[model samples]
Target chain A: MDITSPAFKSNVKRALADKQLQRAMGNVKVGFVKKRSAARDKLPEFDQLRDQARDIKDHTLEYLDLYYEIYEQKVREAGGKVHWAATAEDARDIILKICQAHDAKTVTKGKSMIAEEIALNEHLEAAGITPVETDLGEYIIQLRNEPPSHIIGPAIHLNRDQVEASFRRAHDHLPDERSLDEVSELVDEARQVLRQKYIDADVGITGANYLVAETGTSIIVTNEGNGDLTQSLPKVHIVCTSLEKLVPTLEDVSTILRVLARSATGQEFSTYTTLSTGARREGDPDGPEEYHVVILDNGRSDMLGTEFQDMLRCIRCGACMNHCPVYHSVGGHAYGWVYPGPMGSVLTPTLIGVDKAGHLPNASTFCGRCEAVCPMHIPLPKMMRHWREREFEHHLTPRTVRTSLGIWAFLARRPALYHLASSVFIRALKLLAFGRSRLKSVPLAGGWTRHRDLPMPEGRTFQEMWRAGGHE
Target chain B: MSSIDKSKIDTTASRTRILNKLGATLATGKDRDARAEAVKTHLRQHKRNLVPERGNVEGAERIALFRAQAEAVAASVVEVKSADEVPEAITAHLREHNLPARVKHGDDPGLTGLPWGKTPTLERDSGPANGDDAVSLSRAFSAVAETGTLILVSGADNPTTLNFLPENHIVVLDAKDLGGAYEDAWDRVREAYGAGTMPRTVNMISGPSRTADVEQTIQLGAHGPRSLHIIIVNGE
Candidate 1:
């Protein structure tokens, strides 16, 4: 909702110094990485399924208009409505009107990134309709008035004590002596509080993990069944999703489903993978009476046929973020958007202008782990490099950095001069180190030296070593 | 213009504009017919992709795999010899877990005609769950042995709410309805509901509701059933 990517340097500084955030981020590295590897190891066809998942998305994107038409027709035939929004503002307006028409005072929500992209909750709140986030992590973040730090794990930046504090502050009606010491105790508290919200809310909003054109079904996968309750109990169920979520058939969805949970949370399947087609049918004792799907384009339409087209294949599994080393160090809030990590590095600049989010592309170590672990096989590092090139071409890069790059390029053209200059610089750096192997501080590399010591040159550059006939 | 009228206009304009952008980028010139045909063929055929061998078992092995996978996800499983024994199995499960003797169920014939009368001590009500129920029961349309997932299609017979509202969910899945993989279950769904048609909901429940959102440590019973008990009736 807020563009803090421009201030990413300061955000990273704050995040690095936040001891609680650093400790909480440890879970992302230790928890998601091992679980995903184990789950992938168990399934022999994991890679094949990933390739098939990629193919399915590619095919659908190639004929997306036709698939959208078919999907719309199917949804209408099933007595549901599909409303298309060209932008985030349009999406928020469409959803708010739906709630207003229902005279909704309170609406329960499942975790939907599209809703976050559209800033739907804030819009609804401004319209005097309270939105209750039913997912435990979302509920905790909502109470704290904070955006999700991580997509899959929203309150991941928070520890148990922080959650206990939030619960105490929000649930003032409850007994003060109640125990919120254990994680399970916190879960039970949220479950108890949100159960009534599910029943009382007039409308429900959820995001679709996959939208099937064959049956016009919106599929949501959640370990917590909050989404099932959010949609099933309300009088109106609204699916707020993006155009990229569409697939051609249930079988295609099944192929993708095989890889989604494994990459996201490492479950064979989420506890619930509910496929809802439309509103409550005849003689249906439960489920919403009305169903509506609001599909938002939201700058995604522009990514098509571009180098970033592979990004539309993303299933939002958060695997790239899970495997990301930079993400592990800085955490998600520093990225300052709905998405974070490598996918965000490429995607943020596309949605919000590159002028606002230029630093995001530079926020990577380019270790290639995100692409290796990506189920869609998206070349995230390559995309980020593309963004950097765009940033340079647009003249959005800072003058000092651009001047330095210009100088480097000029020297790079003449290798002999580059070798002489580099050797001189290495000799100067060696003199500065005062015979120590590492320099704690260096004249123009304060950013590197501030965090850790920079190693002194090992007496020779690669070109010098290669030319001495010492290269056996 | 009224806001509703403006919204209607906005919807039409947005749909057209978005579709135009997609068509412009995707269907530029020559191969439009091929792209359309590719989509039509893909949707029409609905071909199955690679199904993992883990769920490719048959007959008794299928049942065994389903039970093992279900237990692996923290769902308890009980196998009975006939539909007549299902009521007793459920009661025994409830008793073992120190739950209430009462259970709410939808009007699915497979569950409705069960000799629930055999277990007179257990109280059973028929309808969708209303949030106060401690246990709810529904019949699985089919189950996938590959992931131990129960596929339940929603209707008058099996309300979708029964699967999620209660603290404990007891599902009665016939052994014959169990398949080896998700693809097999989808095939059954297509045969029953017809191609391109679906019930209001198709819930593929694998285990009791859980959340690992808190420090990524999973805890069960997050706004859904804490315990899921599957009673598999293997009729003679």
Candidate 2:
């Protein structure tokens, strides 16, 4: 909700030293990475499905205007309403107005990144309506008054003891002697507490995984089934989603769904993949009385036809984040935005200005794991590099980086000087090492050497060795 | 106009502005009519992209694959001869789990038509679950044998709450309704409730609800049914 990307350095520093966060983050590698690999292994068509999924998103983005028109027509035909918001403020206003019309005292929410982007909860609170988060991870973060560290696992930065403490503090009305040691017991307590909130809440809001143009349906994939109850028990259902979630048809959604679960959680499918098309039918025994979808543009429309268009295919599966090495070390809060990891690194700059989020793109090691595992085949590293180029063009890069680049560019423009300078530098470094295998610290490269020693260069420069035909 | 009324106009203006911005960004110079037609054709034809090999078998192999996959997700399954055996099978499952014999259900004719009287000890109540109910029953609209998924459409016959509110969900699925892939399940829904329309909710449930949010250790029954027991009635 807050633009702290400018403070990413301090956030990462705090995160690295946080013993509780480091322990909690250990589960991401052990739990998600292995499960995803095994799930991919079982499916022979996973890669093919990724390619087709990418094509589907590409086709949709190319014809986005036509598709949005059709999707709106379908929603209207199905006895539902579609609301559009050009900005985050517009989105927050629309949702608050809807809540006011319903005379809502409390609004229940499923996990929605759009809601976070718009800061809907704070807006509701300001309007005198209590916003309740039903997703377990979202609920824990709501209690702690913290933003989600991870997209899927909002409280991934918090360990069990911290969760136990949060629950005990929040649910003080309950017995103090209750055993909260088991994870199952904690889940049961939250379920019991939130069950009443679902029944009493006046409005329910959920995020869409995919919006089907053919049926005007909103799909949500979840294992907890909180989104289902959030929409089902309430009188009004509002789907807060972005424009890029739309797919052409149910069949297209099926192609993407095949890869979504495997890449996210390594399951064939989530426990509940519910598709809600419209308001309750005439004879329907139980469902919402009204349905509305708020489609937020929020700067995504500008990415079309640009190099960043590939980023629109992202399914928000968190596969890229799970495989990201920087994310593993720093955790998600270090990215200083709602989205975290590699996807956040590229997307944060687009939503927020690149000037504020310049540090995010520079944080990546460019390991390319995010690109390799992305179900939509988004070129995460390439997009980050694009952001870096934008940062450099704007003179947003730090002074030391600019000076080093300027010197390197001056020498690179002259081939003879480049070769001579590199040869001299190599000889000086070799002589300084004095036959040692490594250097513990080096001048002007303390950042690299601070973590580990730099290996010593063999005597000659690479250019000299190549000219002498050392290997050929 | 009032603020609420003005917001209505704002939405239409916002929609136009967003779409126009997208058009400007794209600037592909393609015919709008052709693109709309292509999207319509893609949906009308229901062009399937790829169906995994595991769920693409025929006849007996398909059901077996469905059973294995369902079991892999920790859903218990029982094969019965006919609808007559469904009530008894459900009773046995509830007894094995030491749950109450009373079950809540919706107004599904398929489920209501069963010989529930045969299970004298089982008490059947008709309505949606109220969160206090431990066991609930409904009939699945169709199932996908590929991933062992059950597709249930929401209506008076099968309320959506019965699928989530109860702790133990027992669904009576017909063997005839099980298909080879998700595409086939969609076909069945289209056949029953026409094209370009769907029930308020279509739940494609693969197993009971679960969550790994607490320390990444999955604990079942996070906010929905803890145990999913399916009675596959053959000779439908």
Candidate 3:
């Protein structure tokens, strides 16, 4: 589900052209950026809260293992089962066994990135179980059979007409006489279909926003209430969450929640914050009978003691992604991994494999907005630079980039040669352009000229001006 | 193949886990005593600041105006005096939508009068709020004077799903519940539930479930109620 795949690029490009997607993206501008501003405006104490929130995540991540154990114990005591999964495969297997035990014919799912990491639904489907995504965005993409292009909005790539088409295609009971003209009618029909799936589901799965050690509760925050249904409606409820989601207590969960909605959606809180402990109680009317939490380590535990450990504090608010220029231009799917934007650049290389996702680190313009909006305050660019260094050391960089860097490194040590070569290159480019202001095309620099005009180098190189002006 | 875990993995999940536990253990001490004293302190500090709830609506136009505003957000506005009147309102709303008994569990006694409004026909309230048929009539913990948000919670009385599961949601706000900001509203929730005593879920729904998922079309209730209505009954 990496964003860099040709499949992902095509999906994003298609999404960019989609009328509904544009409409959806416009909401992000208001919902995330503007609402965050409004929420921040109401609180004079907000500045202090950011530092406090950052410190809490930092201190918590400094001892993630201890809290996880406390969380596990509290959950076990609450009549819930906690399975510690060290890999995505472990997590998938744990969920599969639960479904098998239930003899699950159908599964309803809430949005869980860990499930994406393990490719959970595909695995479930392989075993002959029909897994239906309950969230609207997830459901839309499920119809298209595509991976989520964005963390928050999965089907952001689809337009309304396409959605109408998808509903008509999958919804067998759709009346032949039905007019696809009204969007409301289309949405209503989809709702009826999903509502049935929600009830018929044998197993419901979700991701935990935060795992509480004190109460032994797995908390999920969703505006749609789909997550609650995904975990509560079915007989077997499985939580596919990674290890870092654990927060020590309800109080700690509160501090995070205050920042989370503000950072993510600019709301005081999400529409629903469902904290389920184990399963349904004796007299409880609407809830699951069995509950299982699959805590996926998936390289996170190893990251705790390392320089990359700061990444563990991320809350998945998508703030960093929204404010990131590289992400704004290219969108989430371009990052070629589950996580995207600057956070993805730093995280993908480490979690997936530095060499496997090296391009992610290079995708950033390093404007630092991702860090600016990041509640956890991860040093994203620095981590990416560390990856670049590792890539260069391993000679894993593309031959042209490597050769160019090598030449620059050689010249940098010899300033006279550096100036000489830089000047010659500028002169060569000027001659090639032949007084034309912009280069519409360039052979070696096709990556730049592909979608934009290259600004021809103006006047003598900066080195020449500096030397002549007596600055150097 | 089994990989050896860190020695501390046996103790806690990671060092971060240890510090978080210790931090929580410590933060509780810092806030507990002060927080316990906070309720009375807040009650006393803000007692005089409370708004005198006295705007009156004598006619149907005013009722229609309120209902229209609520319906704009996909909420159903019910005009009812007592809890006894709730069942009829629920029935009328369902009938107008032309939906059969879509309610799974009627925590609201208003729903119990309907013969078929029980389980299997049972709509779980924890489910995502959707459906043109699913109608919820809930007691507002507080409403925002500024934004018109209806604050609700999950319990035996109001199913968590009622907030999100229905395309149309009917909330009953006792005009006095209206507050200034989200925090002001939560102060009421805190006053009701306390610092550590949070319900399974608390939903602050301002309008219908909505997503501008397509071209930012501003579609209401993409995942929540397509309509939200709040009825403010005159004082008893």
TM-score of each: 0.97, 0.97, 0.76
DockQ of 1: 0.68
State residue A272's C-alpha deviation in candidate 3, in Å. Answer: 2.4
lDDT of 1 at B1: 16
Per-prediction DockQ comes to 0.68, 0.64, 0.13
Candidate 2: Cα lDDT at B37: 80
Candidate 3, CAPRI quality class derived from DockQ: incorrect
Candidate 2: list runs displaced more than 4 Å: A468-472, B1-10
Candidate 3 residue-wise lDDT, A47-159, digit = tens: 66666667767755644545555667666665667777766776777778778776789999998878888889888988999988887778888888877767776765456
- Tens-digit lDDT track of model 1 for B1-236: 13334345348888999999999988888487787788888888999888888987788888989999999999999888988888889888988989999999888888888887789999989998888999998899999999999999999888888898999999989999998988888889889989999999999999899998888888998989999999998873
Q: Could you give candidate 2's per-residue lDDT for residues A80-112 as a string of tens digits?
A: 888999999989988988888888999999999
lDDT of each: 0.91, 0.90, 0.65
Scanning candidate 1 chain A in windows of ten residues, the lowest lDDT window is: A463-472
- Give the docking tier of candidate 2: medium
Task: Please give, for residues A12-123, the per-residue lDDT of candidate 1 as tens digits.
Answer: 9999999999999998899999999999999999999999999999989988999999999999889888999988998898898888877899999999988888888899
Of 1 and 3, the candidate ahead on lDDT is: 1
iRMSD computed for candidate 3: 8.6
Using lDDT, rank the candidates from best to worst: 1, 2, 3
